[model samples]
Target: MLTSLEFRLLATAKAAPELRHRLRDHGHDVRLCATELLTNVIDHLGEGTPVTVRVIGTAAEHGRVRVEVTDPAPDSPPVLRSAAGWEESGRGLALVDALAERWGVDVGPDRKTVWCELVGDGRADGRPVSGAARPTAPARGR
Candidate 1:
């Protein structure tokens, strides 16, 4: 299944439950990752910027559900950085990293997509695939 939407901060709050329903058993992790990615867009690119969010599911054997957030800012890619104990805000991507099987940024001439894949049988309680090495930064893809 594949779902896509024009993103807006207000609309997202209402969209969450619907997104969760559409994602079925993978709802929790996918919704959280989608929220973090959307928040990054709002924080860094401003709320009204053109953004599109997509959710795509693969075959059961693949055990994968991918979420992608595309924004018009090709130059402002997201960064993954360690937040200081006293800081309150630099942790979005870190949370994405923790939950995604692998996440990356795809830069294009007019836009960039920030995406993450969650791998599992959709049966485990919301955790990422076991033993996957956490990446320090999101990989760059075409």
Candidate 2:
């Protein structure tokens, strides 16, 4: 599934439910990660930046979901950094690193996409494809 959203902080709240619906089982992680990514865009790139979100699932990944957020700033990419305990900010990527199985940034000529993959056992509805719904269910036992 793919969604295009405005770069406002309000859009994050609006987009969260939709992301949760699409992700279903791992909605919380998807929502949180997506929000962090968007918040980063708003904070660094300013508001009203265009964003495209894509959710992908793959059987080869053993029930993993990949969420990608595309924005128009290839020059300003996200970086991971350690935040001091008293710091009130700079924990976005840190949270992403902790929650996402893996995350990365793909920079193009005029834009970049920040992506994160999350592992879950929930049933996915489609084969491994971009912009397609591939719900996954947890395996039996361990």
Candidate 3:
């Protein structure tokens, strides 16, 4: 799904608490994760660009929560490599690497998509959330 953000802190930071309220605190982390990823997408690239966020809750191995933010960029794909000892900037991907259970980039000549996944409680049983109340078996046993 896609949402609008003015690419400013006034909108981004202010959004977290309000979102946490609706999701009953369970989604607070995911919200913040989106905030960070989206924030980077906005700050490091062109202004007023649209962002696409896809959130899927799955139960495979229990289940995993995946958050993907897609935007237009061709300069560089985010990487987990550490900044040199003296550099004062370029730590964002490093931080993302440290925080996410899994993270990577989907790149083409046109745009780059950076994705991150966090292990959630539902993932312990290996199922994917289906419509409403149904659950599907994992494609492969863990």
Candidate 4:
């Protein structure tokens, strides 16, 4: 299913349980990816940006659940950084890289989408979607 939400702190927190419920059996990892993507938007792109989130069931990677987050900032893309031990921030996409089977970004003139997929075998009610699987690749800070 496709659901668009405003990029807000509380809205991101609220999305977790709702996505967990929506994805049902494949909820756990998908929910985590969704949270991370939304958080990135808030922390990087600024809060209150119009964000579109989409979740779909697919046969890629031997059956997976895909989550996509679209925002208005094309220049502010997601990057994987090496967070030091003393730092308290900058690990959101690291977690996404670990949990998602694959993830990538789609850039446009006015917007960009950061998407990730997780290995899943359960059922969902959305169309099939495709994303690159970077299981062993280091996070590219674009």
- The local distance difference test score of each candidate is 0.67, 0.64, 0.53, 0.65
Error of 2 at 43 (Å): 1.0
Encode model 1's per-residue lDDT on 20-138: one tens digit a residue: 55445556777788878877877897756667776655424467766788888899989999999999899999998998888899889998989988775342355332222222224
- Which candidate wins on TM-score? 1
lDDT of 4 by residue, 16-76 (tens): 5665565554456676788778888878866566687766554544575567788888888
**lDDT, residue 58, model 2:** 56
Give the range of the ten consecutive residues with the poorest summed lDDT in model 4. 1-10
TM-score of 4: 0.69
Index of the highest-lDDT prediction: 1
RMSD of each: 7.5, 7.5, 7.4, 7.1
Show where candidate 3 strays beyond 4 Å. Answer: 1-26, 60-62, 81-91, 121-142
Against the true structure, candidate 3 has what lDDT?
0.53
Candidate 2 ranges beyond 4 A from true positions: 1-26, 59-61, 121-142
Number of clashes in every candidate structure? 0, 13, 17, 0
What's model 4's lDDT at 110?
A: 93
- lDDT string, candidate 2, 1-142, tens digits: 4222222223344555555565554456766787788778767887667777655555354566566678888999788899899999899989988988888887789998888777862234433333434443232210
TM-score of each: 0.71, 0.69, 0.58, 0.69
How far out, in Å, is residue 56 in model 4? 1.0
